[model samples]
Target: MKFYSPLKNTICGVLTAGLLAVPLSFSAVPSPAAEADASSLIGAAIGGIAAHAQLNAVLRKYNDTDEGRQEYFQEMKKQLGVNEDYALNHQLDRIMTNLTAGIGAVDPSIYKKPYHYFINNDKSFNAFCTLGHNLSVNTGLYQTLTNEDEIAVVLAHELGHGQKDHPAKGARRSLNMQILGAATGTQAGAVMAAVINNRNITKPMEREADALAFDYITHTDYNPGATAAVWQRVLDLSKSQPSSFQQFLSDHPADSDRRDTYVRRLTQYSGGHVTNSDGIVKVNTKVFTTPAAVGGMSSKERSYFVMGNLAAAYHNGQNKQEVTVDGNTVRMGNQPIMTCVSGDEPADTLAQRLRQIK
Candidate 1:
């Protein structure tokens, strides 16, 4: 199967696994009963057969191009023990697929679409962007992720690589290394170090992906600052234990700029109007005179958001207590809040005025 399609997908590669491309098997097919409790809370695949075909075709196309045909592509998968079977938790697959669509909806169409995703059984926290657009995350990564938002951040980062064409570029470098190795009679490791294996390229590619991910999150419901936390978690998890894996951490240096980048990007988008450390604004309707007076004891704030109208009315109090939605009807608490009003303030204004009281 092949796709002459336009879509980008990326997964973080495990450098250690690149030494060999062995196949992986998590288990014989898990029984339906065993999966009952762990099933994807996000319903079944959205596009059904068509979606499955698109995803599978993209995966197959990874082998069609010159770079894809290179032995490194196959060896890399093998070294990582690529498994297209039940090696992953089915529930996780469903969750990622759902989130993929949600994030894609917000990203530039040039870099966003329903890309196929898979999970490797490896118990280490890593992901990979395959030769073309295939995305894979390790089981350890899925389990290690604290929440769905972090997972989205990771996926967005990988997609950022895809959007930037880093995978194919990395492959080209690897291929060049092999040719140079043949010509100069140098070791593969020595040849790789000159380019693809060089930290110079890898780190920048990662930082680029990080920036793209930051942009994506701000456009979506996920916290824009999620990039830092997730990247930090990946770093911490990489250095945690089983010291053998630590070598991979050293292979590609983490970006210190990301710490500041996260804060800077959110401020750029939200104009520093955002109030919460979580990167989301919470609106309180308990009718407190001032945020300081409440002393942060307000509950029932679950329904309020900085981008919602109630948030605007609660904060600005235009004597009208009104808000406007640009598209479609606005609903709150399952009740019709209001219609899109040209005269009312945009939701983002509230997002700007929104600040964390705590």
Candidate 2:
């Protein structure tokens, strides 16, 4: 019943080190060949079928029973710790909902599954989603984000993963890579890296998620400028460090290209670089796991090894809990915790203010 949240894996790995240290900027510079296609993905050995099958299995199992569904939510609630501030949680929920209202209206069936949120107190920027529309946002993510538009970009990107089944899709992609490597003589350690290092399937997934995020936020009051601006901030903030090193696949995109994509998406939306955001947004969270249930190594274990090697390579360092919600209260075990709305501010108003730079 457990499922892995690769985006969280992606999120958690926000502060990574790179060997080549090819610094990038979030500006618009295009490339014809960098986009993803399943056929040309890695050598000619792999296809998308195996990956799809892997995902199908997870989807099927999660839907098989009420117990499975309950367990899925329970594990997530227990594992990803959250000290929820009701005022914040309620505000986030309302804003996230209102922002994505168009999507819900267009196809409510797509959202038949329940969605929840978790807020972690991490200072660094990271947000990720699980298989069943569960998402986690760092509390400080709001602090770093300059406006609602940027938050929309982050949340929408994570939503895109759930909508597109990117985590399972990525897992399937890794499974394909694993099979292809075994058939074609890839080295053991190298194969490990390709399969679960977050390297093989991440870049394409990132691009796809970015595209989906843009799609969701379009026509909403959210400004497209903020979309590109936040990523640019990422480039600006991380400039001193080495380029980020994800385990398996990476966009390795120059910041310029990444920013450019968002800009282009915005241009398409408002026919210009700047637009007034009249859109609303709201929230919730969870972490997911699919532990390989094997005789030997788990996917997480594989990453830990690769991450260790990666750290040893850089001689540097790196680094969830659980909670429950009942009606308007957030809790830990039997203890009921009280949360206040901080002057009774509406979610929409607070959300709007939170998005702005201090």
What TM-scores do the predictions have?
A: 0.50, 0.52
Distance from true location, Cα of 230 in model 1, Å: 2.0
Kindly provide the TM-score of model 2 when superposed on the true structure, using C-alpha atoms: 0.52
Taken over the whole model, the C-alpha lDDT of each candidate is: 0.44, 0.45
Tell me the lDDT of model 2 at 91: 58
Candidate 1: tens digits of C-alpha lDDT, residues 206-313: 777777776666555554445554544454444555363454356454434454466445434543332333323333321211111111212111112222233323
Q: Show model 2 residue runs off by greater than 4 Å.
A: 1-59, 63-70, 105-107, 181-201, 240-253, 272-358
- As a whole number from 0 to 100, the lDDT of residue 158 in candidate 1 is 76
Model 2 accuracy (lDDT, Cα)? 0.45
Output the worst ten-in-a-row residue range by lDDT, candidate 2: 280-289
Q: Could you tell me the lDDT of residue 235 within candidate 2?
A: 58
